[model samples]
Target: MAILGTSYWNLIDVLKAGGDGIGDVVEALTQLTPFMKDANVITCNKGTKHVSSIRTGLPQVSWGALYQGIAQGKGDYTQVEDTTGFVEGLSAVDTRLLALKPAQAAKLRLMEGQGFLESMAQTMESAIWYSNVQLNGKQFHGLAPRYSALANGNVINGGGTGSDNASIWFVTHGDMQTSVITPENIAAGVQRDDKGEQRVMDGAGNPYYVKEELFTQHAGIAVKDWRYNARICNIDVSDVIAGTVNINALLRKAYYRLQGRRSYQMEKPGQVSPGRTVIYMNKTLAEALDAEGTNGRSGADNFIRLSPREIQGEEVQSWRGMPIRETDALLNTETRVS
Candidate 1:
């Protein structure tokens, strides 16, 4: 008789499960421009985050007769759902710079090790940012990709369908948050064996292994209410002030939409950051904002060019008192949509 064997989890599933946790973490080195640091960071401590939000489709009110019974409302009552979005799971950067050759540490005075650590940290941050907003071409359900501004269908065309000059993403600190399941803490000044396991040595060791604490980058955006954020797309900045394609006018229109929304309720008093709207765009779009109108004054004041200054330890630019954060993550040459 043949021996019976129970089939368990597949190897790929086992590897994925391991990657999702801290034990037996595998590190893969990837390179890209990091910009996730610019986003508002909200720390969380859960595998999946549950975001509760009220739907934008609220029921409409209707006029009723004085003596007769009231008529039924036209729209369905909006309900808040506990929508859950998964956290991004990417292995940490595991690398370091150290001279292991005998007497090499004496001659090698430059802080190459420190520089490598900084560069690695920055690269990890950028990768997280890219993943946060990037569209998943495959395995759509495996990774919880955040809402894409370009895919929102709300666009400002440049010349036509494929040419987009500028894009705008209005995001609030509450709209999303970056959570780190495992922090990128450095485990330096230690020696490791050839098998890449840490071990103590009485004296200096040759060809020492650079052992560092690598972590998994886990983050999720809780768009509890998407009304708090808006993406203005299809903006063709090169177009001359035509019948209805003025860039400056378009910007103002987008700004007011956020300002005028019932959820924003700008008229209400004692609102925090009422004018503290954050506008994120790339350098190309930033320049377009600078040249939106005939002159600086006529251009979108909220999109004007401003000098960078330290705001609460972070260097950020302010336009019309609102922060105009420049980020290359917001791609300028994006596939256009109607």
Candidate 2:
């Protein structure tokens, strides 16, 4: 949450490792969104998928006398495979148009590329939180689907019953907890390949020369340890806007739902050990939390305070020393999580 460094490489780190121009493209994408900037990204251990053995139950321990023998117990484990999804985009520019504006052609092509980059960023941001593999097998399952049921120990109900609802997520980014992943032997961020000018057919079946660019990103979400993440679902947006919902109270519950509290540690300067937690909500919910801090209402000082601080050059709001990031990916029209 505090931009700590871990053994795993983030999108920027992976792009920079190539020592080329791809870093510029990734930098632009991360700057445009909050999730991409803070997401912990790693390479998939298995070529196109990540296979992990999750511990579901602990072994039993018993005390015995010196002459007595005690039975050994083994911990329960479940294997989970997270498959990476390929998100690709293509951009085509008429070759004639480039020739018509020779001096401005490079700038024009760059502008087109930026548009595609932004679109891809938004797609990935939404998929990370809402994609359901059961509904569409081509996409990887996301956090919302995993915690869709109230029976899930980490999901907290916000008392909303209608469709005008949203969610607040407490995600711990770590190798053993959760992380964003890319396929093995592939770069992490969107890879851009320039396909030189070629004959492209128009909608009318006419053939013409056009320059093409392909953008491809192979990524997915991996929740290796489910206990490290929590979600507060069914928040009524109207109530929050009317200053009626006690968001700080729900935030407290979500915080406690996490199995581990001290999930992050500072090993050294510019180096972050695993286990960093961040709180995510939409803009409406974020404004509600800010209002609570300034309104001087009851219980506001206990767990909510808006002391804006700069982290990595961007102003960030914190609740109990954890960064609270706002994203558009969490919808306000979500159905209640029953």
Candidate 3:
């Protein structure tokens, strides 16, 4: 029997499933960003908060003689509450300008709204990997903070000791693994509300009419099973540029770190099904990887394969059937993760 591939859903999927009217706008806004397009999203059933029960330890199994009594063992579990943060922005355009170009008034307002949407999309992307909820209570804890320690089981050290370092991430998006969360009863993605034209005081204390719109997105990150995600950190940028660091070898290590025999099991008795896994790197590392793919080095040709699959009409590279996506949210100037 052939196993079917996992189908992952993002914020736009959730919105469309719930019959939200802004699905097209959300798709247009996030289609250009790979992270936003591929991230798995879930709606909270507990209003603004969602709680997950994580299995920390497995039950002990023991063999006994016939008719002998055995001690019962229970699995250890912990509950974590994930809260969604509100990201809000206001777009206001001068009514006088709109009046000057009456024929293009709607276009002008739409252009202003596009700016707000683009900014919100970028903010959410950055927050997914770098936001620190402890320092800034308004934001949610991101993947970096959760896997910051090198000793963590899922964090793979790249042995880079410089400041110009980067990381490659392997994320499996699924309901039981990791996903982005939204508040209950709220439409997924950015919600826009037109406040109409209102008279407001300007910076010079002058009164004027301005068209106003409010944009808000409620989102957070949830790592239900942390083992499904892997991070290869501390890759030295200088070495990569000099053709010294072998990204393919690091990727192979990450593959084994994240992929297992149980990952392919789906909908079977006593088996945990896996999710769709994807790789993420910054532009610099992506280019380096491309260079390595065509460098004619021994055993390098078979490592990274350029896939025919197109994401938003752009060709995406792959490694072992997993798509490799590039996003600006990942920085090439990260400090060494020792």
Candidate 4:
């Protein structure tokens, strides 16, 4: 799910590292989704609390002869309630089997634990991506609905209604994108049963217990600035598959707008100045993009689907110098209207 270029942000690791007190549940499940490894994450300390972020509004100046102090422009602040809850995934293994078949049991235990964790991770990724698309969830609102309301200009239809390939790509900078936070007071970690408890096999002593849990909440996708983020909806999959639409051209347009944003020059003070760009797409769209790049046709400069290699022990592909990763969490089936 990873690609060649560097990620704009870091994935939050609640268990080993600290967070902005939000998105701990999802952060703890990073191993399940490789693309999530590149996302910026914050862990907070509460299930539901108001989180504030500084946003710069319009500034003013005056050219006076006497040199009197001009009125200072007060920056804007965005406060949103981040509410997160606990989600737990568990796996168990009998002790007797481990004691009897040392190596085999160890491998089986590792495999089972890994399988369970991967499933949970995918679930978390799906939830986040779905929310980003639908802009509505039980706990947090998503980006699609928020950006769609910004103006009629932001929500571009992919094609006609009831299209089979209804895909969307979210272009965003670090400044105006959605924020995920967790409560600071909550402890996000994995619990392993060292004690011989939850004995599944009566004669086999106790079974190993593993539990992973955390909470998360999402802030509004955009504050006062709406230009930093955009949505490319109603992308016809058939076009790319049939070699009609140019994937690189669409990406260029989105990335161009993202780079041209003027509000909130940086994500945070003392950080890098220029913003980071990301193209959020599902597997089907990603495949189409890959096909567009590798169609064996002329004028395809930024070819797609680079060789798969191990990056930090994880296998991933690359596209157009950016990381072209796949996540099943994104919705391939969507209805868009002109």
The model with the greatest TM-score is 2
**Model 2 segments beyond 4 Å from truth?**
1-32, 263-274, 298-304
Clashing pairs for predicted structure model 2, backbone only: 5-272
Report each candidate's C-alpha RMSD, comma-separated, in the order given.
Answer: 12.7, 9.9, 11.0, 11.7
User: Each prediction's TM-score against the native?
Assistant: 0.51, 0.85, 0.83, 0.62
Q: Per-residue lDDT tens digits of candidate 2, residues 1-338?
A: 21213322233432343333322333344423577677788998899899989888999999888999998999999999998898888777777766655665675567667767888888888999999988988888788999999999899999999999999999988878888999989988899999989786655777778788899988899998898899999999998998889998998998898866643332234434457788899989998888888655675455446676566787888887678898987899999999
Ranking by lDDT: 2, 3, 4, 1
Residue-level lDDT of model 4, residues 126-180, one tens digit each, is 6554454233344344455554432445555455345655545444444334444
By lDDT, the best candidate is 2
Q: lDDT winner between 1 and 4, please give it.
A: 4
Assess candidate 4 and give its TM-score to the true structure. Answer: 0.62
Model 3 root mean square deviation, Cα atoms: 11.0
The Cα RMSD in angstroms, rounded to one decimal, for candidate 1 relative to the true structure is: 12.7
Work out how many backbone clashes candidate 2 has: 1
lDDT of 2: 0.80
Q: Model 4, which residues run further than 4 Å from truth?
A: 1-32, 45-50, 54-56, 67-73, 93-103, 132-139, 148-155, 168-180, 185-196, 199-227, 259-275, 294-321
> For residue 199, what is the lDDT in candidate 2?
88
> Candidate 3 on 1-338: residue-level lDDT in tens?
21112122233433343333322233344533567677678998688888999889999879999999997999999998887898898776667656655665676567557867888888888889999889899998888988898988889998789898899999887788888899988877889999999887755777767788899999998889888899999998899989888888988888887744122213335546466787899888988888777644475456445454555566777776678888888888888776
